[model samples]
Target chain A: MHDYTMPFGPQHPSLKEPINLALELDGNYITGVKMRFGYVHRGVEKIFEGKDVQKVLYVAERVCGICSYAHSSACTRAMEGILGLEAPTRVKLLRTIVAELERLHSHILWAGFGLHEIGFQSMFMLFWRERERVLDILEAITGGRVHHNYNKLGSVRYDLPKGCEELMRKNIAELEENLPGLIKEFEKNSVVLARFKKVGKISRKDAITYGLVGPMARGSGVKSDIRKIDPYEAYDDIRFNEILEEGGDAYARAKVRLTELGESISIIKQCMSLLPPKPAEKWKWPPIKTGEGFGRVEAPRGEDFHYYEIEDNIVTRGKIRTPTLANIMILEKMLIGAEIGDTPVIVASFDPCIGCMERTMVIDKGKKNWFTESEFRRKFCD
Target chain B: MKRSPWISHYNASSCNGCDLEILACLTPRYDVERLGIVLRESPRHADILLVSGVVNMQNKDRLKRVYGQMAKDKYVIAIGACGISGGPFHEGWNMAGPVDKVIPVDMYVPGCPPRPESIINAIAKLLEGLE
Candidate 1:
């Protein structure tokens, strides 16, 4: 076997994010993996400097479009904590609703991508089609599917749109009814199980040592959901079980996501049922004077934390630690010793937001040319 | 209707908003392919070059190369707030400026990052212009 180096992305279909994973291989097996990120870095933190505390929400959300609301929520919560203010009950409920809705969309989207990576095109299409329902519900409520910016410092920007409850009920009911079928399809499919089951195993010890969070950690048998541990918003009000799998493989991660999708629907139903009556008084709070704060939210991928430094109501410094950042470390670990052919499946299992992961520079080795999709496709197919 | 344009997407220096929306337009929901628009990774294989993000000095040369590599009669659509103007990140020293400063833009779709529908509409207008 000859020693070969392969660059995985910056622009490859297998990689959802713009990361370049240079795998040094001896024949088909990966001996070593070099990871490079920042291809998608927009220098958002640098731009946040000197912006008003309120305005930083926009920049923060832009950090990861898939997890936009989670980032914004984290920022707002951090700011709220700094100002020594707690959001109104109604506002907290609304935030929880939006956050859970985001999780539904993100997880479904990931499931779709995972299917697609393994050549299950029909499953991919079906999952994305279903995800559209979540997007529509989000759009109906916040007027934007991806970047809602609905979470403001003190409260949300707008009240629930007309028919919002009915919409939630319809979607949640539909999702709940359909989830068993989807799970059955996944379980019965030998190819899916063969490809994913125990493909990328992350042990409990390694997961804890890495400090991984979200479904990735839970998949590895680590009960570390921020929602369960640090119950925020309506999470405390609703009774829901944290989905877990002990396999810590690709299949386990997928199963965790699939189960959470069902849980998210139930949580949404509870929210709709417990939604408070429309308050007469508009929610308002005094602006910040001088304070620094940190907020953590469980995004679909994992725990997303935002730290902010405010001086005189203006953001002096803002730093966001997206779940993908934490997950990326674990992904590199999973890639080691895996067959190069399983790269896409391994990469997709992390559900990496390349938009978030592409923050590293692509170092040119000058030996092998930049990786193209065709070359990758041929290699994988072969 | 006669000739659907071949589109190429380039990320200069952006927050990925415009890029995701552009992809959304290409997906089954918007299905820009129905209009004969296909997202080609290679610039040489495209008819309409979709540029996203603010032009930074590091990426300026690559942007120009991609633009220059396109076949004649190719259209350039500057999508999103960053490409149309300098956008929010325009004031930085490292930023080379807006897409217009480096290349002639055939169309501009504005939004902090334009929505998928807006991107579809921009493509429709560009196709109509080509006809």
Candidate 2:
């Protein structure tokens, strides 16, 4: 068969976000993959420069909706680190609760997408149905569902509303009750197992070499979860297991996320009980004089890091490194030898946030004499 | 409406807030399908182009292309704050403008990321306007 190039995206159904994948196909197998990003670049990093430390938090949260709370927390923590500001124990616990909730919702959302990619519509519905309860918990705590804007400079935006703990406890119980059955079905389903079991396999060494983070690394048995390694917020005070799998395939990645969902629930429950007496709102942010610091959080997809340099309350330089940016490069390796049919499944397995990953790209066609637009119009529009 | 409206979603330089909410709109809680709204993958078959996010330089042309591909008498619902007025990233060097500047938007659903119910209301209003 002749080698042919198939452009997969920019706007394709298989992709939940915009990403252009130039796939070199030899019959059913993909021989090469060229990725073009920046289809969704809103100039987030550029926008961060010269913004007030207070307002930058909102912009940070908007970096990616799935991990909005995490990004916001990371931004706040970065500012706090620079100013030597430490939030009270209760504020730390509250931040942890919201962050874990963000993790649960993001993981469940990805699971649903995974099921959808594999042609399991009913399973997708089931996953999302359970996810709504998680969203309810989020809505109860933070005002908005997706853009929670819950993180402030030194403390979170809101305290747990009345009965919020009981509500969370009840929701956690319901999720714990339902997740096992979902996992059992996912594991037993032959079609799901067939499509994902050994597909897009990555070795532990390769995962490290590719700089994979979050579940993508944990799936390959690399104990690289930043939460456990470098505990932040209330992570040091809380106890939770770092979920891992040794299979290093798409199935393993899914398993890691599913298991981590339970871990997130448990962490939230622990955080709720450990809440300190002082209200979170009482903690205030100190005036930013001049300093630089880095903050990192274990976001749903993986490690999310933010580094900033502030001079007189304005962020002179700010850098955010989201997990998808760390994990997306590995797709080039994973998709090289996979079948065309498995492209979407393998890509979805990474749970890539292309919106966060897109930087900038200019499509340069060079000096080649291609057919002009007028030539095409003259040929076809006559 | 004579037939179910098939909708196609386009994310033109969004932060994914509006995009995820659009996904949630289809899930069990919202179950937009009950409104005779089908989510189609291809732009050609879609009756309503559900656009989320601001129009950036790179995606502006792509968004316009997708809009042009839709059938005649189609409607465009610009969802989210970014879609309506470019929101926080309005001053970015890469952004061209909001959705309406590039394409003819019929209805606007405004939120940082509008709720699923809000999206449904926008759809209902669009249908009402169509009548």
Candidate 3:
């Protein structure tokens, strides 16, 4: 009948970024979970208060590494809306290529992390190996691996280099050939299935109630993909199904992301072939003006939303709502009855990026103190 | 130098870009494992302490605590521009400083998110210095 507390992270190996979860345990079962954000806060919104609209796009892209292009595209979209400009058709296709490519890499990365959590080390290696090809395609087109900085106000920074499309097609073909087996292995492998199936179940009602987005909602059959509901970029022209699952569990989320890898690859191929036969720069916009607008893009995780208020061609205020922020509350519901061992995988399954989730700036009074773990333990425990 | 080196990774207020690339080093293509670099889940087992991102006020203590936990002879490699000098977030209110301000840095890998090949090269250069 006794419950004791244990800390999960700010620096635990299971977490990819800095975020703390204070777990209260009754025997081996997690009785309660308390999450603390702000470890990775860098005053991003405050930083956007008065910066020029064009420069703010660079700041926007850095909000999260994996979804850099999504953030940049959304920023430019919002800026374009403010200016009442429509980017060239070729530019839209180019944006779609990078956005879909970002999705491909981000989903594969998440799948690898999930595999790592389930103790499937080889699968982790295999997925990341496959992810390298995606990253190569990104580098070949955007000239940067992580922060592509590819989006400008009314156009992409660069066109697909000579032979880049062929390279992309070749890589996508390889990924398509290999991904089915990976999915099969995930479904058929006893350990992965046992660890993942119904472990972090979320009902449709609960998913809707929690306001989940992206795969988190779709996995539970909520039909919440922003791209499908409200198309952007060249998404309006693309023909692809919104990959969904009715499972509402960890396995379901994984399945949605894995299936989306194929969807993203297909979307990119379509964009490449459909690229308007004109220069992207021809879709240029007039000089900036004062207005307010909203930008939304379906990032690898979910719907990435950005709001901008411009005054005299300067961004007066900007707000970013990353998918991880929307999905974090579901962890409280999912962890209520989960075994303690399930904590890491459950948290990982949500793909929580604390840096992206927390955007506030708060001063810590005890910032100067440096206490070692043993010292803290000795002081607090003994 | 031992054929294999155990690496401990810490993210001190990073944007998560470089952290992912550090992870990519473990994948089969740019496999840092071939050079015998294993990512240790604990600081005590590490020979190379890999620090990513800028050190913020909230994380500075934990970063120092983690570094303190590593073995005495460990090499600390600061990965990405933020880890070196706070990158684009240099003037942010949350930044305490770069990773070097909190602990001694042995090598610096500069990139928003350095390529896996570049990360591998940094590790190789560090190992070469060990000789």
Candidate 4:
């Protein structure tokens, strides 16, 4: 078979987002992979400059559609860190509740997308149907289905409203009843087994060395879940086991997310139980001053880290490192020897949110760069 | 028979909010298929272009190429704040939209990410206008 090169995406049906992949193929097996991004760059970090903390919160939510709340929470925490203030116990619990719900929504959406990639259209539709239930609860709470804009510096935008508890409990019960059966069926399905098992295998050492976070790392049995390793918000108070799998393959990663759905459900239930009588939590804005802080949250995809330097309540310098950016580089190595047919599944397996990860790419020049908050300040603001 | 409007979607630097809602519109709950609306992967086969996100320099030409390849009677419906306007990222350095600057848009659905129902409504309205 002659060696042939094929370009996939930047625009393709398999990819939900635009990312161009250059594949060098010898017959069906991939000999090399080159990735090109910047198709979805919205200039988020650049937008952050000169924006006040409160305004940056809204912009942060726009960072990633799937993990909007995670970015906002990270942004809030970073601002709060700068102010040397902490949200009250109730506020932290509220944030955790939304955070877990976001995780559930994101994972289910991913499952549906994964199923679609593998030609399991019915299951893909089923996963999305399940996703709507989660979205209903989120909409009920945040009043926005997709972009919650729920986070604030010292408190969330809205408190848990009356009758919200019953709604949560009802959905929790439904998800609990349905998710297990869905996952069980998925596991037993021969097609899923054939497609997922041993494909795109990542060893434990590579998972660590590559600095993988979220389910990608956990699937390889790396203890890199930020919620477990370094608890933030109400995570320390919430009792849930960190999900792990040693399969180190696509199946393992999928299992990690599927199992974590149960963990997220339990965590939401716990947050409800811990809900305070008067959950309307808020704090006064402090006097304008200058400081810098770092915030890290375990987003559905993985660790979402944000750094900010606030000067007079406006962020003069900001940096965001979403999990996809950290997890994406490893794709080059993983794709080198895989079957061409397995490419979409492998890419989908990574859950590449190109929009979220495109903050620092310039396709015209083929340059990729990330800046620390301090370095960013010195280079741009100073 | 009024054929289902085959549509192609392009994400132009969007956060995926509107894009997800578009996906939802096709799923079982919204089931735009019942309305005879099909999502096509190729622009040539599509009668309408469903565009989401803010336009940026990098994706601007690509979005145009996508729009250009569509059928002559192609209808462009810009979804969400980023579609009609850049929304939050409007002032961002890389922004090249509010999509109309890149291509003529027939309709605009408003939301940070519009709900799936709203997206269905927009399509229905578009169909009505077409008649």
Model 2, residue B38: C-alpha shift (Å) = 0.8
Order of the predicted models by lDDT, top scorer first = 4, 2, 3, 1
Candidate lDDT scores, in order, read 0.79, 0.87, 0.86, 0.89
Candidate 3 versus the native: TM-score?
0.94
Candidate 4 lDDT tens digits, A1-382: 9999999998898998999899999999999988878888877988898988899999999999999999999898888888877788888898899999999999999999998999999999999999999998998899988889898777777888888888988988999988898899889999999999999999999998999998999999999888888788999998999899999999999999999999999999898889777744345776687999999999999999999998999898899999999999899999999999999989999988988899785434225366665765575445
Point out the worst 10-residue segment of candidate 2 chain A by lDDT. A373-382
Stretches off by above 4 angstroms in model 3 are: A280-286, A361-382
TM-score of each: 0.89, 0.95, 0.94, 0.95
Cα lDDT of candidate 3 equals 0.86
* Candidate 1 C-alpha lDDT tens digits along B76-131: 88988888777766654356788899999989998877888888788788777766
Model 2 regions lying over 4 Å from their true place: A280-285, A362-382, B1-3
lDDT of 3 at B57: 85
Clashing pairs in 1: A17-A354, A37-A359, A37-A360, A38-A358, A38-A359, A38-A360, A39-A358, A40-A358
Candidate 4 C-alpha lDDT tens digits along B1-131: 14678888998888998889999988988999998989888989998898998888888889989888887788999999988878988887667768999999999999888988888888788888878
Whole-model lDDT, candidate 4?
0.89
Colliding pairs, model 2: none
Question: C-alpha displacement of A360 in model 1, angstroms?
Answer: 7.7
After the best TM-score superposition of candidate 3, give how far the Cα of residue A271 lies from its true spot, in angstroms: 1.4
A1-382, model 1: which lDDT tens digit per residue?
A: 7899998765565654445689999899998988765445556766787898777887778777788888888888888889877777787788888888999988888887788889997777677767778888998889887778897777789999889778877877777777678778987899999899879899999999998888889999999899988988778989999998999998999999989887887787788778788767677755658978899988888888888899998888777788878877877778888998899998888887765654333335468746574763364223
Q: Ten residues in a row with the worst lDDT in model 4 chain B? A: B1-10
Better of 2 and 4 by lDDT: 4
Candidate 1, superposed: residue stretches over 4 Å from native: A357-382, B40-44, B55-73, B91-94, B101-104
lDDT of 1 at A32: 92
